[model samples]
Target: MLLLTIDSSAGASVALTRDGAPLDAWRTEQTTSHAEVLAPAVQRMMIGAGVTGADLDGVAVGVGPGPFTGLRVGLALAHALAEAWRKPLHGICSLDSLALRATDAGVEGEFLVATDARRREVYWAQYIRDEKGSRLVRGPFGASATDLPELPAVGAGLGLYPQELRPATMDEDPSAWVPDAAELGQLAEGALVGELHGVLCQARPLYLRESDAQVPVQMRQGGS
Candidate 1:
């Protein structure tokens, strides 16, 4: 099966795969550049891999526990591609993809996958690796550093998170911290087997908290 995976959940990523073998994968640091970079990357990946929209069997996108703007870039792109090509679209959680990347990097024991969510909070989840696979234990929630469960060999999207969230065993690789589109494709393959539901429409970006900027200011003096 040929699949295209896009992940703008943390860093922007685009990957092409055939029968689970990665044909091409591209990821770039785009702290706030998703709007400008995602599409071009998609087009470039297609060209680099010698594939076209029509050649893809499915599309896998990282639905996020991320900042609103970047998350939308990927989700919108995936939706547009799915609609245009009339192909099955799958959504994978951005945090799950990060955790998968961490595990693939040789992380053992429980893990606390985290991404910075500015304003002194982070998007985080706790997972435990088992015979089946890693399962979420803490949250897909945004929390202050104090709120996360004990970190475990933590990695993935660290700049989007707080320093205190790093575990004692942390194997920090800011580069590896971002989600892997190739891994996203692999997860999509697993989901296709009915191991997990692959609902494109129901796939919502998991923003754990509303933007801090959106919070209404309270009067210190008294009610306004």
Candidate 2:
């Protein structure tokens, strides 16, 4: 199946995939520019692949435990495109994509996947890969880096708190280790094939914490 995938959990990334294999991909590590860069990145990938929304079988997105602003940018676009194209929308955990990357890179046994959650914390999960595939074993929790267990960890969290989170040998350089749309697409494909039941979810934002934005006290009290 041909799929267009997007992720803004860390930075912004988009990809075109066919039967779980990447056809083309684009990314930018500028976190704050997801709103500006994500759509164009998708357009560039689709054009490069010589396909359009109509040619896609579905849309896959990283429904993230990321900051509210970045996650909304990607999820909103994915929702709009899916609705317009009348295609199924699949949501893969952004942390799962990171685990896939580590597994593909040959990290062994159980390990942790984490990404920067800002405010000196991280969004983290544990996984183990075997003959079947990578399986989430522990968390999708949000906590300070120092609070995370000392497992060999991969993802942007390593870059932020290398001293606290042990860096997996395969992912020593975590600077560029954000969730990839292509990897997210692969996981979605696995679910479509029934190999990953319960892994894919509805196309919705997975914000693990409450939004920083809040109504003022006067507004809540009906004072206008």
Candidate 3:
């Protein structure tokens, strides 16, 4: 299956894959520009891979534990592309993409896939790799970086708060934190190629916390 994958949960990446292997992928190093960079990045990725919208079997996306605005950009585009191509869309947790990276890099024992959720907290998921694939042993939890139990940590959360925990080997690789669209594609290629209905039927954004734009109850109650 030819799959196009997108993820903006951290930096933002677009990829093309066949079966479960990546053909080519693109990512922005500047983390804050998802809205500005995502649409064009997707276009470039497909073009570079020598594919067209019609060439895609389906779409896969990172369903985030990320900020409201950034997370939605990728999800909206995935939905639009899937609808445009008339193909199934699959959503995978963005942290799963991070965990896959760790497993691929040979991180042994269980560890945390952490990403900066801002507000001094992180979006964390725990995983252990077995022969099948990585398993989520704990969280898709959102909490203060300090609150998470100590494990070798991987992801952007460590970059943001160096004081929080012992860094995993991946912490040295800057790209480690950014969700890889290629990895997202690998995770969802099975659904795209086979029974799309049985797995993720839609590409949905996973915002684990409320939007920053939402007023706190105390602040709202005092407002005229």
Cα error of candidate 2 at position 169, Å: 2.5
Model 3: residues with Cα > 4 Å off, grouped in runs = 131-133, 169-176, 190-202, 215-224
Q: Is candidate 2 or candidate 3 better by lDDT?
A: 2
- Candidate 3: residue 203 Cα off by (Å): 2.0
What residue runs in model 1 are displaced by over 4 Å at the alpha carbon? 156-163, 168-176, 194-201, 212-224
Q: Model 2 off-target regions past 4 Å?
A: none
Writing each residue's lDDT as its tens digit, candidate 2 over 20-76 gives: 899988888888898888888788778877898889999999998899999999999
Top-scoring candidate (TM-score): 2
TM-score of predicted structure 2: 0.95
Local lDDT at 196 for model 2: 79
How do these models rank on TM-score, best leading?
A: 2, 3, 1
Worst 10 residues of 2 by lDDT: 168-177
lDDT of 1 by residue, 83-144 (tens): 89999888887777766776776666787877777677767778777776666676677777
Which residue pairs clash in candidate 1? Answer: 115-160, 116-160, 116-161, 156-177, 157-177
Give the better candidate number (1 or 2) by lDDT: 2
Q: What does candidate 3 score on TM?
A: 0.85
Error of model 3, residue 33, in angstroms = 2.6
